[model samples]
Target: MLQRPPAEPGMREDEVDTPALILDLDAFEVNLDAMAARLAPTGAKLRAHAKTHKSPVIAGLQRRRGAVGQCVQKVGEAEILAWGGVDDILVSNEVVSPLKLRRLAALNALARVQVCCDAPEAVPLLEEAAAAAGHRLGVLVEIDVGAGRCGVAPGPEAVALAERIAASPHLRFGGLQAYHGGAQHRRRPEERRAAIGGAAEAVRRTLEQLRQRGLDCPIVGGAGTGTFELELETGLWTEIQAGSYVFMDADYGRNEEAPGFRQSLFVLSQVMSAPRGTGRAVLDAGHKALPTDSGLPLVWGRPGLRYVGATDEHGALAVEDAAVPALGEKMRLVPGHCDPTVDRYDWYVGVRGGRVECLWPVAARGAMA
Candidate 1:
């Protein structure tokens, strides 16, 4: 069930309910504009990953700022965006399920959709779905560009898969999905640069093979917030798939010289307890509200207040030089990982200048397939 609006327009940020997903509107807009300006020169459109914000409202904001399209990891997310009027989308991941491919292929009536394929066997299944729908499906060959998660090995192996995809009358060779997800949070700038450098070289070789095979690779897609600049430098990528730039999660902020994005997404929590003599305070928001896979959320703007641990319903703060937070005191927490933390909420309490400006649903929350 959907909860009531955490705070109405004109209400103070502190007036919002505890554990609310509050967006710092000013900071959020700045991050969006900064990304638009940063990528405007490179000619690579921001295929902003919807797995992060998961809101078509946010997608519309990005579209208004010049994003070419959105990228999703699942069919459910794609359906939410397409229903919400996102015309162009890429799965950016493989969809090997027969039923899921049919559902994805069905969206062709409403939007321009594409999916990534890394194996030859997946091609025939995609072909069946497209033939059933009587529409051509755009398929991107996902090359394993350092991220060993999901992708075909770059070079002849990837080229061979592309051949299989291009041979299918129902499928169109879209491009490559070369995102280095693990490199995004690498602490050092040099480490990130080196990681993307290797990925780019791999992409370069795959493109060469595609050229030799006489395949028309319309789009070469990939690049996250950490190494988007590096991808742009190579001039090999045609689409930049950055999603976290909209919400600077704590993990990304820890990067040395993190891509000049502000901390815009925060979980508004309140101090539920603080013993008079104790050196610790407990926040109402914990594991359920914030994902700690990346690390603990940071208490925003609180110098000595550290969020040390989290349980199901409470967050433990180790107070030091900072004063113990009083009961009912509201605070903002910079999430350790923005994407999953976003999945915990039903709505975003948009706040600016200490007042609530608007409320937007987390429309695609839990859109996992």
Candidate 2:
């Protein structure tokens, strides 16, 4: 088990409480710039997913970097970002509840709001809500681009959904939401490319069918950090929805090399207990502090150390040598998954040049409705 770090008088980086959520500002901005540069010539605008950072400050930075808009997973997230002054937002997931749909519809009174629909049953509810709110909502038909999650079948079904959305007085059929979320972590570059290729083909067929029906799709949005290049090259995706590029995590680092960006987000943890043991040490960050669904955290700057295990509030590290640091030492931990790990914290402890720079709030952290 790991012990908590001792409190100090002032806010030194080392003296800050253990298991704090840390954002490496320099690295983060570099990642941001790299993504913007890559998308500059492609003509594919970025709809950076706010589900990853959930920070208005980060969203503003992305907006400044040429991102056309931000994509979020829920109405609460849309509300937060819209209130935070984001001009464009897409509720990338489907909104079903009447109350949630009302909230989503209400956003149109302020900013551009797009939402997804994967089922026929959802359309009437959304139409009713939009009509009730007296707002025009942009609707995207979510296609199951191999994620097997929340999307309708890719071809004719998608066309039919689009037709329904287009016919609605209060809603406009925007385009298709064809995202292969599982492909982002497929490890092999070729595998990811192939997965996206199939997804692109599915989108292509869907678009053809829609056009055959005299329907035009203004947007076909999809792609994530790990396999965005493939989607960008496909010419099918008009917009790429990548959020993790701003804060790459351990799992993304495990992706095939030659990636356009680098890891930037980390959890700053303290060595609270330096108990004597070979190949075993403990840290103050655990499951609650750092998500491990993708895998355990990788100890940044420590080549031989491994964050092998964890509990609710403790992380055990497997030290490869006897020269491990003593108690009160601070270390940076690369999170396994940036999105969920970020959702766990309210504040992002921005650090630069080994010093605390600023604290940015996770404005939409728990916007899961």
lDDT tens string, model 2, 205-290?
A: 99999999999899999999888899999888999999988888888888876366777788889887778755467898999998
Give the Cα RMSD of candidate 1.
0.9
Write the residue-wise lDDT of candidate 1 on 58-142 in tens digits. Answer: 9999999999999999999999999999999999999999999999999999999999999898989999999999999999999
lDDT of 2 at 172: 92
Q: How accurate is candidate 1 locally (lDDT)?
A: 0.92
lDDT value, candidate 2, whole model: 0.87
TM-score of 1: 0.98
Question: Can you tell me which runs of candidate 2 are displaced by over 4 Å?
Answer: 1-12, 277-279
Candidate 1, superposed: residue stretches over 4 Å from native: none
Query: Local distance difference test, per candidate?
Result: 0.92, 0.87
Q: Considering summed lDDT, which 10 consecutive residues are worst modelled in model 2?
A: 1-10
